[model samples]
Target: MTLEEQKEIQQLKQWLMQSQHQAVISGCNDILRRTREDMRVSQHILKEVLYLKAVAYRLLADVNSAIETLNELISYFPDYARAFQELGYCYLASDRKRAAHSFYQATRFNPALLTAWLQLEKMYKADNQSQALALCQQQIAFLTSLPRALLGATDLMHEGQLHKAEQVCRQFLASNEHHPEAMMLLAEIGIQLKVYSDAEFLLESCVTLYPDNDRAAAAYQNLLSKLGKFPDAVSVAKKRLQYAPESFTVKVGLAHALVGVGELEQAIDIYRELLSENEDRPAVWVALGHALKAKGDTREAVNAYERAIVFADDFGDAYWSLANTKTYRFSDELLAKMILLVDAEATKLDDEIHICFALGKGFEDSADPTRAFAYYERGNRRKKRTLQFDIAKTEKALQAQQQAFTKGCFNKTQGCQAADPIFIVGLPRAGSTLLEQILASHSQVDGTMELHDILGIASSLSHQATPYPLNVSALSNETLSKLGEQYLRQTRAYRQGAPFFIDKMPNNFIHIGLIKKILPNAKIIDARRNPMDCCFSGFKQLFGEGQEFSYSLNDIGRYYNAYEKLMDHWHSVLPGEILTVQHEEVLDDLEAQVKRILAFCGLTFEEACLAFHKTKRVIKTPSSEQVRQPIYKTGMGQWKPFESYLDELKDVLPARS
Candidate 1:
């Protein structure tokens, strides 16, 4: 009985053991299979979540998050140019154009990926010709000669060569008419040429396809405003302002419109408010300077422009404008204070140039040539490199222009007030503009601002537009005669009030020889200042529109040398046609000097000329404010403040010094 029971139990135990072993093997297999499935699901889930997260991040304005997600996705699938494009899209949306451009570079070609194409097109269209051209430059700069040619054309356009610019732009369009950028450029060319209707039409067409886009808006507004429908322009400006109120362009328009309708006082207030709200806005200050200068508050104008440069250190323009305003003749006391500032190391290049020039003029005004010369010499040498050349070039241009005028005027009909114009010639800071103001005060003489007519004739002689001809070595007698004719024809528009208009283009000294030949009836006044003070002032004061020569000292010196040679030439050839005014003599005795000037111009002396300081006139020169007030001795002997820094002018002064 015991053996049978034991055998049955053992059989049961064997059956249970076999079942347990099968169960363990089945469980292990199921676990391995399930683990593999779980991994596959996890990989898909992670990728999908990352993709959605990127999309969500972009929607939430988290550009960096979108970028990070795209970066992670690209790391897993490097062929995903879509991810690259998305990353670029995020960057573009963030207004990082340069970075977006780089990302766009990595995007693969896919015609169906219209977003990428549109983005690229927009980027290219949005940039300036020079800047946009830079993007394609590396790709095309070496590929074909056409790119270089295009670049040349672009530069010519920038320098105001409109016809040449149009020719180049047209040539570019001929080959690539549908190239959106080229189309946009053509539109710009139309805008520049004053074919505003054509430009407006083109821009409107562009907007129909790319509705509410920036480029179309810009084109429409720029063209509309330029046509002087300022109210419409302001309305357009407000539309743009609605979307981007902080845009310098839009704000400039608003400010300009306010200034345009004689709302200068309001414009000033707008600028002041803008500055208070955001002192970092440079354009606002620049606009303020213009308004204030127009209102005859030049000191505040200078200060506002100074603040503009502070906000935008690289803006050479603000420096130019500030110099122009502050550069007017300062009182001897003001000049002395400025000189002290320069000596104290608080003077910028602009400050030093202005003060030095003012000091020289002051000394001359005070009848002290020695001190005036010292200051002029210092001032000239302090100007920037570009400004020196400008001073010289502008003077030369004026001279050639003047001689051309004389020639042209003599040949004209007798009814045309064949009475020759008087030109007061000298370096800018040497009291030329000031002399013109004084001369202009006379009833018989009409002193106008710098004229382009003479330059036009000179340029005509040279076959160059705008700049006319020069007294350079390469002139023929026939060409010079034609230039003279051209000059006379151009200046006919300047006639007003008097038959004897004073063409007070001071730089006319260079071509006085030519002038003597053309207009035997003309009068020329050479307003001489101490060269040192003159040049120093030029170097310190930044001219607003042109005259890049005043930024450096070496250029100023070289310019002075050129002027001296030209003046010497004129004096030798023209004899008594030109009158010389030593700044010091005029300064020492303004009354006596004024009388002499009157006698020279063949005018009867008036009691009003004796009180020249009280004569109300539009003095557009730097010294307008000072000239409005009584002449003062505040500017004499100003060089003593910077006597320690006069190593640049130790003995380079004229022989008179």
Candidate 2:
């Protein structure tokens, strides 16, 4: 809103407080009329004006008008807790059931609504609902026990005023330093802001100082898992289990951590045991499906996913999991059911996006490219709205890396001489995993899941004043060696006594400079694919996490452009230090490309590498199923059918070489 509009809103609120009901209503209506056509007016400003108008109508005894105003407000902001609370007040005298339901919804969205809880408690007591009354009392007591500042911060956080909440939390911590709850709240804010290092430090300190604080420990474990520190996450989960041996949530968390650490068997056992105790949990079924898929049990994984859908047909993740297998084809009946769910108004945004992608895949398999592209575009558009990707920021960061990592920078550093790691770096869906599979089939090579240790190291350095690619030029030789050693030590858990192991993180393309400075002996492979095929494939896929650039066609195109520019810079500065493996070239002659890859990594050619599809190691990527079979030319030029709709992507991508 403009400054004058904001000032007018303040005046409306003041009039409402002074019981000038008619004046407040008239003023709000005027503001709404003036800004109705203004696209610049924010949703926040509109919500404030409508809410104020509703309050004024309520005070003026215009019950019908008040309800109408609130209903209108809710149409735009359905999750507005205060509007629901006000509706509860409007219905309190004439409709007890509606009032109770409205109050319940208010608290459901924002648990800090004390008045709603109090009203619910009173109503439940009057209705002789002993269980509900007791629950209400419990919530009220817990909320009342919190410090006032912390409570206000919690409320603000729930209302999406994260910066204001962070300010309140910091102020509270300023006076009440070491307060576990305050520290945890601030850490949560940090996590939401994507400041992982600060969040980790705060949570770690909170858990260290308050060992008995299970909440802090749980939060710390979650952050560790998010950062892909699976070993550390597993340790934290075990400690939490020690504290709460019988806790179902903690057990489930430990199982997830075990899965992350590649202890699939143990994780599956825990999941089964949990299901035996509580068989109706669809989320558990989905998690079990993922573990089974990673364990190379595709048939059993499909069954597990189907079971989840049987329980909750609207469960989009389960359906998406089935599609993500890249081998599963949806039946007409299943596609119809997914279509219904996608059209359902009650389906959540997350579930809708997943189902859209699944439906896109389903249609694509059925040879309906037009319909498939429609759903893919729908999913990408919706997903992009939810993400905070900035193509310009990404381009600038790559450009900075180009400017920072020069030939002279590499000349001064003596990095760790360990030749254990072979880094596979590129955009997602670009056959990096295929290369990893080929190399991993060799007897001397161990294939690990996309390890995040290098990214973690880069993240830590980015938090330093100098930041990543630039920071590399400032590191001493000893520091570089230690950083390399730290990566090896961290990734050792994923290795099984191989002379060489593969770290096939595709986005690690952006961190080649860091890898060079730390592990100078490490072999780097740039997995390349046709721009159209790779970008379109990424647009169709729904990643579990990260790869935010893939949600939009334009973003993915620009990202690929930046990636190519940076890779060109790398080649120019460090000639013969990196190998580029084109997917099409590998498709034309798998054996020849496999020999070239093995040779680059200083390994002798092996027959097993040629028969990579027959290798029985666990594969975790979406290409897991496709890679298990012999080479096929079907994936080549798959984007041609959707070419008419890909002009935006084509406009930004580098011209075909």
Candidate 3:
């Protein structure tokens, strides 16, 4: 409060941050001794010195030394709440969760110590439990007891009960304007809830108040990146890098921004550098793989993916990445290893979707569709979409796309290169894996498992500055043609020189428009299954990949609905461009349906398509294991298995559509 005291504080900060850390430590010790001898040493002064020591040790990564310092500080003054909080973190650094919790609770009685609860929240999150109410309650509850309503409301914002938190924030701000912390909290929460405009506003307001906080810089950068403002994200990352160049998280964010701006080489270089610095970090390796894959280095990308998993096991991401890279030797050995992993963990684990799905792909690649189908069914059962709705909509889309496609009244000529992959869309447990096997058996067709490649492109494009279909008028026909040409070029690597390549990505049903503009000649296949089964199947499966929407029942149902609506809209706009297939119909008359599909593709009906059951092709979808055997007459109209659990999804399903 006084000039002299402020001067002393400034001098202390400088002394603590001097060029020589040992010199700074010695200076701090001398100051403390002098202050104590003069009877001028305060509890605050002691705490500050201890805090500096703890921080220095932490920076050096001497966890034991940090713990000792923090422990000594707490023992010297057990009544100081911050001491307990810091000591708790030290305990946590040493993996003594219970001890850390004890100290955190001790600090709870002294509400000024925010780190106590914040660290507790981190501990909970690392263990993977949601704890908004428990950890975030500190600052909000503290502010609520104070005179500043704005600060109180702001505290609640980051605790994550968003709507209520915002109401508190607005109400507080209405009484007294320009409360910076409150505004920052509101902005931070807005970003979390995907309200970009509000977040930008609050973040801007916070910057005007506290311009030097690295945390604020990172937060703003993240918000900008998510909003598809890559340039802005890059700018902020540069500022943060200036402040903390060795910050790995910040480097990762910067790398992501570079990648977004199509600076593949630069991003790759940055990631490779970061990987070298943090050699064992899985994320750096993962990012390297992403960059390499985007740049079209499939083999190196696969190696990077494998290295990532090797460094960090239990990472389901590597499996998904490996499957997508398609660089490894697809052999029985890979499948057996995956199977062993799953089998070894079967008794200990309640779910095996990760292992089962990956192993199933191996079997499918081996042309053991029967075995592939079994694994797929196993994984799908874990997913819960059992054939009902998958079969129904699959049939409906099949008929609709087929009829429209047969009309063949296009205004333009058919000279453009189109993606003619057969897609099997529906809920996971739907008979898509079986359908893929049958279709892949055709001589002219190459059946790859459900590749989410097209969907990834569409999703990534949606995150672009000018999202397609959103600003359709902004795109000229030439641009559209260019986009299509680019799509063809990108997929050329996977062309396999086949007349048709099956793009069995189920989610492609959601992006039929992007598919149409790029590949006017591409065939869209919509696979449908029962709603109850679909949702149930989704709930049971553990994807650990891009199906972020599949983790919850409602999210999965809503996602399916969105996909269906989009498919229907695409069909209306581009009649005869898509082909829909029903799992049930295919099962009933495999030869007839296969013959009709072949005819549509301009190929004569091959008896091999009829004997698709006898064809041995790798069936890589979750249905891989199931399709290896003969077509089963069962699995159609089977809602009994999930009837009790289908209540939440009953209205979500299409009724007789």
Candidate 4:
């Protein structure tokens, strides 16, 4: 804790890092002897000392002493990935099987452990474990030849120290320019930071610099898919598959690309083929379930999820996949198992979060509101720890938008004449997907996934010092028009020659001014719901990605308030350009609402729109199953049962609209 002690510890750490075993041992022993005389040394520093001592012992070929030191350190810091990795090294030097298990734990805790992964690959190869061998090889291919310095970055990344990891990766890349591994690692960190443009650039560079590197190419293709550049992703995927004809990982990448391109059937077929070839792969089953669920085949999707559970019962994703259906009823046995697994000590954090959400859904359906709310709250709390949302920062950003996007902002630029896009924007779990389903049922509209083009554009503009809408206000009419054209070109992959297409990105509500400036003729539908219902619905639901605000009631309420204020601003400034549709109103009179929605989109009324439940199109949101059934008010007041526990939300949210 003292400056002198800290300096001494750093020196020892440097020596250990440089593999000076004798020096590390002597320095650590001197520190330990001094610490015994002075009780000022904290447990935190002591743990690090023990860890370094274990490393020194391992380097000195003292396996037993290394194991003893590691055991002592792990008793207090059981989740220490590096300690487990050291234990793995020591065990591998003594007992091969134990070493494999230790390495497995190392990778389980910190998936970015390239050394552990490579060691496991060798162990699995020796044991003739083909499936694990393939998985390990796939992981190795992700960063085939990691430079020594980048390993520290990867470790930091796996431990969720992304900013630190980014710093280290950038430092490495500064000297080792175009190093594919460092680029891929930094790109991954960029993805986690929501800096998609930078991530895309790095990935693109990685792929171009190493075209034969399957992993870098796959990472690039995956980034393209994440950005909703499915056509481009498909091109890249096809090229990668052409080179690695027998690689399952490449095939899976192609399946993801197909799904993104709205080729659900093709994606499903590919997933099925992959499963047939590797029947025990739980991930393949989950992927198949996703495609089936998106394609609106509820029964088959449930079957696929069940198969995933059967293959790997403790797999949390499979349970979450089933619960995400919103209509899947958990049998007593399954429910009990989920309850047990949710609290299991061995369950990984991500797995536990999924299991907790699934249990919440199960209890909700069983009419156990108290139990359901408890599980939901627990799951939300767990997820909130991972999010970096800041309410004050969000408020500041929202205020900047209001100040920048005055009525005059839109008057400066004449938007493109493309009336092809029908935009559904609102808060998540507020019926945007349902609106998309209704519109997609109409003959002229093509229902697309929550297209990322608009958001992507906003993110690119978000890099300015002023941030977001303030930065967007500087764009010229020509630039706006070009952006609009680029959006249409990017989204063309999801259109099937339909005159209009639906892009139901809920968060686009914040960018209404930018939307009008780029595509003034585009239809905008604001999906509004009751404040409590919308916020609580979002709180209970687990999104596959984004919506970080939904992980906590206070954050959700603050976001909803911001969203409401922005919607009011958009309506006042751009009247007749945005239509507001209340969820309850849709449920109250489905036919009338359908007519109104169709009329607003400048399309004729059709009876098919009234029967959107039977439209037979792909649905990907949490509301997928609910939207497949006839309109009902069952979801209307479900929030009341849990209202007593929602004071944090009530304190921030405006009254029901």
Give Cα-based local distance difference scores for all models: 0.58, 0.89, 0.59, 0.85
Residue pairs with backbone atoms closer than 3 Å in model 4 (clashes): none
lDDT of 2 by residue, 1-657 (tens): 579777888898888889999999888888788668776677778889999999889888898899999989876666678988999998898899988988887888689889999999999999999999999999999899999999999888777778999999999999999999999989988887777889999999999999989989999999999888999999999999999999999999999999998999999999999989988888999999999998889999999999998888899999999999999999999899899999885576678889999999999999999999999988877787655567888899999989888977785248888999999999999999899999999999999998888878887787778776777888889999999999999999999899999999998888888888889889999999999999999999999988899988889998888898999999998899999999999999998899899889999999999899899887889999899989999999889988888888888874752
lDDT (Cα, tens digit) per residue for candidate 4, span 408-471? 6676237577999999999998999889999999888999888889989988887778777777
Error of 4 at 465 (Å): 5.8
Question: Relative to the unseen true structure, what is the C-alpha lDDT of residue 457 in candidate 2, on a scale of 0 to 100?
Answer: 88
Runs in model 1 deviating more than 4 A are 1-285, 298-417, 464-496, 513-519, 650-657
**Location of the lowest summed lDDT over 10 successive residues in candidate 2:** 381-390
Worst 10 residues of 3 by lDDT: 385-394
Best by lDDT: 2
Indicate the residue-level lDDT of 318 in model 1.
57
- Which residues of candidate 3, in runs, are more than 4 Å off? 1-415, 419-427, 456-466, 611-619, 654-657
Model 4: runs farther than 4 Å from truth?
Answer: 1-106, 112-145, 654-657
What TM-score would you give candidate 1 relative to the actual structure? 0.51
Lowest lDDT 10-residue stretch of candidate 4: 408-417
Sliding window of 10 residues with minimal summed lDDT for model 1? 407-416
Each model's backbone clash number: 45, 0, 42, 0
Candidate 3, residue 13: how far the Cα is off, in Å = 27
| Candidate 1 local lDDT, 477-537, one digit each (tens) | 4554554555555555444566566666665665565555455456778888877767665
**CA lDDT for candidate 4:** 0.85
The number of the candidate with the highest TM-score is 2
